[model samples]
Target: MNSKTKDAIQIILVILSILMLLYSIIYLVNYYSENDILTHFPSNKKSEDTDLLTPNEIGDSIGGVLNPIIGITGSILTFLAFYIQYKANKEQRKFFYIGLNNEKQNRIDESNKNIDLEKKHHITNLKIFKSLVSSMLNYYISSSQNIKDFLESEEAKPLGIHLFIFKTDSSYEYFNKLDFKNIYDSIVYSFQNKNEDWENDFIKILNILNFYEKLLAEMKNTYKIHSQSKAEKLNKVGESITQEIGYVLSDNELKNFDGIVEFLEIVYNSNPDNTPVLPEDQFKGTDFERLQDEFFNKYLEKLHMRYNETANEKYKSQLDKFSFMNKKIGVEKFQTVAYTKHLREVYENNFINQTNFDKVQEFLNKINIS
Candidate 1:
């Protein structure tokens, strides 16, 4: 039963016991007084009725009154003692019940705590995955900046004027980046574990990852990119550049980049100089192709490392799986925000998701995604 119900029952039992005990005590006192159980000072049993002249009648009447009081009192005491004993037994039973109930509740509470811990880590780990993705993408785009300008200037897009800054490895910048990653991971882990001090950080990371995911998906769609072929489609996204036939094609529009090179070499060998055939880039010319390749490879390497790194960090403990998952959740959420703000802007505006925009605002309150 519930605490309130148990308390009410206990109260009723105590009251009944007290009443019975009081009745027993009162009855016993009256019975004894009437009987005159003063052992040392004995009462005279012989009675003299001066007017009626019947001593026996007087004594019989007195005895009749005393005997009933004595009997009633004894019965009351017996009943009272039994009732009180019953109440005490009831109390012990109730105590046992409470202990059992508390044990059950404690188990449930611990389980819930374990569940919460897992959720927290999952979120954080997800965020980490996204961050790695973002880092790879950023590296590729930034690395290709000079090549983009060169290609465009060669009249592919036709503007010599560039508008973006060139940023190399500044010690401070590298330090700041490392610090940010560490802090982000720490917060995610702490929140998942329900560390009281990290409550605010946990909430912040959650909003961050959600925003990053929305950004990346929207951006990818906006670019209208398609894979090279049916076979290529099934390949991991990171391997896009190394595949012989790429979606990004040259001018002759040959499916395979290597095919273009081989064909050109064959023609050149046949006719040394009669409008010589060109390699892939000159024919289907993209200036940044070579540079893009370098960064793209790095990006793939980064993505592959995630599986190994995360598994190792988790220690592959079944007992700690929940904690690991909770970290992932946080990471995923953070990644959403990072991608949305950083990468997607190149093509479209998807700062917030359609379904969760309102909730996103509520979670982050007022902050710049950029």
Candidate 2:
């Protein structure tokens, strides 16, 4: 039974015992008085009064009946005390068990937290190790003479014309001032003529590009695994590692590589004797029109910003290096059958920025077609 119920039962029993003791005493007193058993002893001795209880007899008679009731009441009180003690012990045991359970749960929770922390630390270490390895590989590749030369070459420096459009106005100016077409034609001629030195350098560049591509793919796989496993931190680490691997090639080199690959593909596959087609014949198309609209508008906007910013001292110093006096060449002269084909292919592959494409498109659009 519950503590309250047990306590109520004990209280009722105590009340009943008290009442029973009180009733027993009353019954004894009434019986003695009614029967003349407890009458005072007479000073005059009489034979008839011999049947009455004397003072000593009256005390003995009361003791005989009262002793058993007192003993019974004492026994009930002792049982009540033991019952209360038993209930107290039971409550203590229950409290102890509850405390023990709480402690066990706390230990389990602490262990789980430690395991999770260790797992995060391990993931962090792995990310660091992978990033270091990628950096080392990038350093090794970039340190090579062939790759270094390719990156530093004037052919690699023209960000414009490589991806059908220039990313910045400075690149277009560089292209015009450097007479990039002649340099490009010379490289193409070397490939067409099968120059061994140029071919070997090309092969080395391709190999390096391939290596970076593979590394990026591996990093992407790692990212996918972490994402699927629901490890958000690990996924972010993978993304960081992939980005690090991607930076193996600089923006300029990447653009140059695209142009080189396109040039190489044409030289190796096209008819060697094929005459270069006119710009109007090669560049006109619905797709080219769309590309022009998308790229040229944004380019013009940025070009306007660049013109306005030219008053800045830092910009003016940079602009002073390139002479703006040279007569600008017609886009038709450079937009040959091969170059047009390369542009279209690059556009289709999404290698060129559509907005930056507009920059070149706007410049080309403003040129007098003659």
Candidate 3:
């Protein structure tokens, strides 16, 4: 039975036992007095008043017989009361422990569920990274083969379209000055004047690039949840594509192209002890002066190591040089330099003020010495 009900029943039994004891004492006293039993108990006395015991003597005799019975009953009642209370306390303790165990089990279950969810999240991100990398490789392969085949063909030489013509100074705005659609259409139209096969090959390359340009926009959203290394590789591939195409076009032509600037801003903010002394941690608008200065500073820190290590003499010569540039820097440093520089020139420029130039000087003073 429940503890409460059991306690109530125990209370009733004790009360009833007390009432029965009281009733038995009252009934015996009345029966003895009414029958004149106490007065005749000795059997020698005839006169009622003289032979009957005194009131005090009768009271002592009654008490002598009843006290032991009452004591025994009281002892039994007390023991039962204690036993009932002990049982109730034991039930309460059991319930408490059961509740504690259930709560602990619930917390463990919740923790396990959270761990599973995190694992799924990690797996999903891995799949997304792999898929993006695969698409990037596909884009590279398809475009490269098409370009190579086109260049190797005799018909392509007549167009005077050496791939080198597509190369520009790393910071040039030759592509940004004009519209992408116009350039695309112009190239396609020029190909239309040639054989059908040439037109098809040129269109194929253009289509691949166009697809990648769209994919970059999507990567901006995905990269926020991915690892920094994956994002860095993505940024590198994007720069390589833009460099080979000799132009930043479409969404890539934006100042904060594909949110890459914002991403880099986060990186710079997260790393406070890094060697490069940034004037600011974020890009709020078209603050090209500060941005360009930071990029230039990173480039100088690289010491032209990438240019010297490159086997392609033409490619090495194409890199901008400074007396400060050399081969002592590491690959990671060169990548950081190149990536920052790419961010600076990927879009159009705005006029810089004297104050911006002063900020640039201050930034340079701090990092150049360090």
Q: Pick the candidate with the highest TM-score.
A: 3
The candidate maximizing lDDT is 3
* Pairwise lDDT winner, candidates 2 and 3: 3
Using TM-score as the measure, name the better of candidate 1 and candidate 2: 2
Candidate 3 weakest ten by summed lDDT:
159-168
Candidate closer to the true structure by lDDT (higher is better), 1 or 3:
3
TM-score of 1: 0.31
Clash pairs, model 3 backbone = 303-326
Q: Would you estimate the TM-scores of all the predictions?
A: 0.31, 0.33, 0.35
Q: How close is candidate 3 to the true structure, as a TM-score?
A: 0.35
Better candidate by TM-score, 1 or 3: 3
Each model's lDDT comes to 0.42, 0.43, 0.44
Write candidate 1's Cα lDDT for 129-175 as tens digits.
44543453344345345434432332322111223233342322332
> What is candidate 3's lDDT per residue for 1-370, written digit by digit as tens?
8868877877876876687598668866774775477465634444755556555666677677777767777876887778777887898999999999999999999999997775565444434333343344344344334433433431222211122111112111222344445444444433444444544443454354345454434433332332254335434533443353232123232222333343244334323234443555442322222323453344333324544665554324433332212221223245434433432332112111223223333322322110
State residue 295's C-alpha deviation in candidate 3, in Å: 52
What's the distance in Å from true for residue 109, model 1?
A: 2.1
Tens-place lDDT digits, model 2, residues 190-260: 34544344534434433543454444344345434423433333233334423532442233422232222
